[model samples]
Target: MVDRLRFFLNRIKERLWIKPLAMCLLSTASVFLAKMVDVTEIGQIVPLITLSSIETLLNIIASSMLVIATFAVGSMVSAYASASSTATPRALSLVIADDVSQNALSTFIGSFIFSIVALIALQNSYYDKAGRFVLFVLTLSMFAIVIITFVSWVDRIARLGRVNGTIDKVEMATAAALQRRRLTPTLHGVPPGTHVPGGRAVYGSLIGYVQRVDINALQKYADKTAIRITVAGLPGTFAAPGRVLAYVTADLGDFTDIDICQIEKAFLIGGERKFYEDPRFGLITLSEIGSRALSPAVNDPGTAIDIIGTLVRLFALWCAPIKDNENIRIAECDRVEVPEICLRDMFDDAFTGIARDGAAAVEVMARLQKAFESLATIEHPVMRDVAICHSRLALARAESVLKIHEDIEVVRRLAKFGNSV
Candidate 1:
């Protein structure tokens, strides 16, 4: 339930309208509340604050903010287009969901709505002396917010659509997902191991990616029914019609449609995979960027080399165990089974695309070999083996692509090192 709720909240936060709508509600309430306070009662104690003064200020803000909002929208559209053309399309979502840009636009639009509401109330004689003072103070505070937000937005908009900026955002998101998975390798459950005894398959009704899994809810159901549920497909796995979503083992009775539906509900199926808790998707996006960089039209080896370093840092973090303070402790069922992400699969996702597209690029291939060698320094045997395998694959591709002996010799020397002296 926590994982699913986190995923849902992330989706809501990414939407461009959610923040503005929230600000609108707050703006409406502020206007109404200010009007309810009778300012005349406190006029003698607090000096005179005229409605005309506040009204004039609001009128100026109200008129100017509409144009500003229009400009902001236009800027956002241009940024989106720039990101799509320069970076991989997969990264466009990160650019769109940028908090600085979204908050700036929301602030502009929200301030406009507030000013308009205040103007309407002023024209309707809704403000008493004290009410006018309250609105005046609120408007001044808003002005500060707008100025600060605008400055930050201006600084951010300069680079928000750049390829490097987009890559950083994806890397940040991926690192967060990887950290969460590190804490809960089995996603807060024990590993199901290879198979389940007497486990019957539960098929999915739709065809899509498993975006989220409500493990807490599933555990609750398992406890109630005294059954063991093993999740065959982790988040980011593709599910087709009648494909096995999970396996159920219980002595009570056969699986009913209601039970199957309940299982399906725990797994949030979606048209596209999400980066919320899917590290694989993040690696895939990074690889996509590398592939795009290596394209004949782009022919940017530096970008691909940069991504090699990024993947190395990510894998290093993944190899390290979570500290006691860093692990998120929560109540989870012991009967439920989940599959941990395989080390080899991550290597495949992070390297294959780059290898395929960057084979001929000596700089990229050398960097790729160095990255695998770095991962080989880790203590895990599986990680070392996977790194070695990918290094060999990359070396072979470099051998076939490089017509020059010097370039091939460099790659061969690095591969021979094998992550050790």
Candidate 2:
């Protein structure tokens, strides 16, 4: 259930309306709360503010905020478009979920709603001396919030849609996903050993990407039924109709249709892949950015270099050892099996496209070599071997594309650290 909620929230987070809708509800509640506040006792202590003054302030806010909200929406749409064009379109989701822009827009809309609500209430004589004072205080607080949000939004808006910003966002997302996977390489379950488990294959009904798998729930079900369950698909895998998602082994009998339906619910299928638990998706998106920048029309080798550096940093994180203290092994059910991510796959995802596209660019090739060199130094033997293989592949691509001896020599020198050729 918790994992399902997380999946739901992640999907909702990408929408622009959630924050504004929440803020609107809060604003409406605030207006109602202000009316309930009793100021009769403190009427003598607090100075009585005139209704006209409060209404005038709210009028200004109400009128100006409409334009501000519209402008903010326009700016956000423009940013999304710019990010899609400049970076990979897959990264537009990250830009859309940007906290700064959403918060700023929510503040504008919330303020507008509050002002209009207060203005209407005042015209209806809903507020007395104390209520007017309460409204004034609320308005002041709203103004302060708007001011802070606007300042932060101003700083973020300038870079929100740019290539660098999108790269940074993707890197952060990738790092986070890698970290999560690194900790729980087996998704809170024991690694499945090689064993012949003869059981019925339960398949999903729809064709879509597997967004998330509720491992805990699967484990619980396994524990209850005393059945051995092996998951065939991970979060990033695509599910086809009648495709075997999992294999269930039971000594008594095969699982019923209702039981299969319950088991299938553990896998969350979506229209598109998600990056929250899928590090490969993140790596692929980063590579897409480098591929975009390396295109002839863009001819931006610098961005490709930047992406190489980002990939280097991400792999370094992936290379770090998982602490022994982390509790990834679940004791309840050892039957739930999950596939592990191969270093070779992630390495290929990170560097293959960029290496292919930027083969002719000396700067990109040099950066790619340096990135592998950095990865080679990490303690993990698999990381070293994977980096070494890519380094050689990158050098070979460069060797084929590069015409000048000096350029070939430079790449060859870097290749010495990876392969003999």
Candidate 3:
């Protein structure tokens, strides 16, 4: 239950309106709270603040903040559009969820709301002399906040829509997702045996991607029914009416519709994939950006090369050794069996598109060969084997696509370099 709620809240945070709405509410509350100063002893000792001075400050804030807020919105929309055009549309979410940009816009709208509310309260004579003094102090603080935010926002907005900036955001998100998966390889559940135990199958009601799997809910159901539940649809798995989400190793006669409904509810399906629990989605999104860059219309091999380097760093995190303490599994889900993410699938997600699209570009092919060579050097045998395998595949792609004999030779030499490593 807690896991599901946290997942829900994280998705909510991604919506652009959440921060601004919260800021507006707080701004409105602060105006009323300022009036409470009239009851305090400090209000009696504070110097008198004239109504004209307070009105003038509020007027300045009201007049300027709305304009600034409108400008901020326009700039952000342009940035979003630029990100979608230059990079993959999948990366637009990360660009929109950028903290600095969101906070800056929130500050502007909040300040505008504060000024408007304060102006109304003053017109109604809501504040006494002391209360007016407190309001004056708040107004000055608001000005400082707006100035600082605008200055910081100016710097961030400059790069927010650029290709490099979008790639960086996607890389960071992918890295974080990869790290989380590394820590909890089985998602805190016990790893499956040789094969999933077969029995009754449970299918999802919807046709879409599985965004999250509520393991705790499955565990509870398993424990109550004295059955073992084997998860079939992990996060990122596409769901349809006929697809089995999980297998219940119990008698079909004993299962009820309510029981099946409960199991299906544990898997949250959405129209699109998310980067949170699904690391492959991030990998695929990055590969798409690289592939798009290599498209005929873009013809930018440099971006593709940059993406190769970023993927290398992200994959390196997977090769990093996990401490014994960090490897502890959550024993609470003893009745649930979940499959670990496949290494081969991950490699395919990270490199297949880039390899296919960038085969003709010597710089891209060379960088990819070097990337494979780097991964081959890692201490893990499986990673080394996979790297060598991909190196061979990429070499084959280059041989078929490169028209020039010199370009083929260059790529072939680099591909062989991985074997020597």
Candidate 4:
């Protein structure tokens, strides 16, 4: 089973399917065909037993439309399920190092959001007939809920750095801790500025089109319209560059190679966010900057049995009875061992929108259906089980979505603000 799971995960990792979108178009044709197909199936043996031409046509049209609708919704659910539950192993290097992908996190979050919208829409559906409406949504919602649940697990697939920059920073700090390194030795322990040794420089007696104001040019300067600073970093620091080089505090200087100490006096006290947001933050990923980021090839069918191995690693980490003691073995490639607190955090977050009580369950579930549909179109067994667990336990029992809501403030915050902009 583990081998098969790994093999299956490998087969469709990055496939781009157009089938879901085609469903509506194909269904339209199918609906018309269903209408015509009904004619041959129903023989005009007697006048009373047989319907007239107009009635038969109407019946065919209705049946065909319903079938098309169901087909369209089913295709959508399958697409979402496939993407979320793909089980593709991430980039090999990253897996070995345990570096998580930020892209996957974003995609997971995005898929989550999309699933919510789809589910909401699916639940709100209005079919031509009441029974058809319930059937359409029941089928659609099940698939969609499964998708949302599967995508929820994408975090497990994601690399750590993608979710929390500080996680990697802390790991880097740990490495730094082992070595004898000087941190801001020159800054006298103050929060130090960064180096800009060879980058371009600007001078400023600055002036530019500013937001509409009643002030005159002199008044603008008097009001410090251009925030001026006498910086060793030089003139461009305070002024806009595109406009006639705003007043320069210093004579123009060209960038030149110099000793590290020479540029150390200068600081990018505030500009680093704009300057290095890309390379500093973006360049660190496993994938190259211009290309598609990390794609783990963990799911090869031939080596798929190893997925069970990975699952064992994951499960030992997941269901390990012990906490934080290194006696339990997880993975050979694993660097940092799993802590029980990690699973605590995940399950803590999982209960955010869960339902409790029959009436509330119906409503929250109705809402869940809507949300899951929009965010993703999931339909995996494990995912279905999670939703069903909630439905059976929390909703049926009238317990809070997060059973221990009061005990977990973090979960409460996440639930209340999950949709808040």
The C-alpha lDDT values of all candidates are 0.85, 0.86, 0.90, 0.28
* lDDT (Cα, tens digit) per residue for candidate 1, span 155-250: 998888888998899899999999998888888777776654357787888899998887887888887777788887798999998678888887
Q: What is the lDDT of residue 203 in candidate 4?
A: 30
Checking candidate 2 for backbone clashes, the offending pairs are none
Instruction: Indicate whether candidate 1 or candidate 3 has the larger lDDT.
Output: 3
User: Which residue segments of model 4 deviate by more than 4 Å?
Assistant: 1-127, 130-148, 151-421
Order of models, best TM-score first: 3, 1, 2, 4
Candidate 1 segments exceeding 4 Å error: 194-198, 252-258, 328-331, 419-421
TM-score of each: 0.95, 0.94, 0.96, 0.17
Using TM-score as the measure, the top candidate is 3
Tell me the tens digit of each residue's lDDT in model 4 across 6-63.
3234333323233223433443333233334233423233122212322333333343
Q: In candidate 3, what residue range of length 10 has the lowest lDDT sum?
A: 250-259
For model 1, the run of ten residues with the poorest summed lDDT: 251-260
Model 4 TM-score relative to the real fold:
0.17
Selected candidate, larger lDDT, 2 vs 4: 2
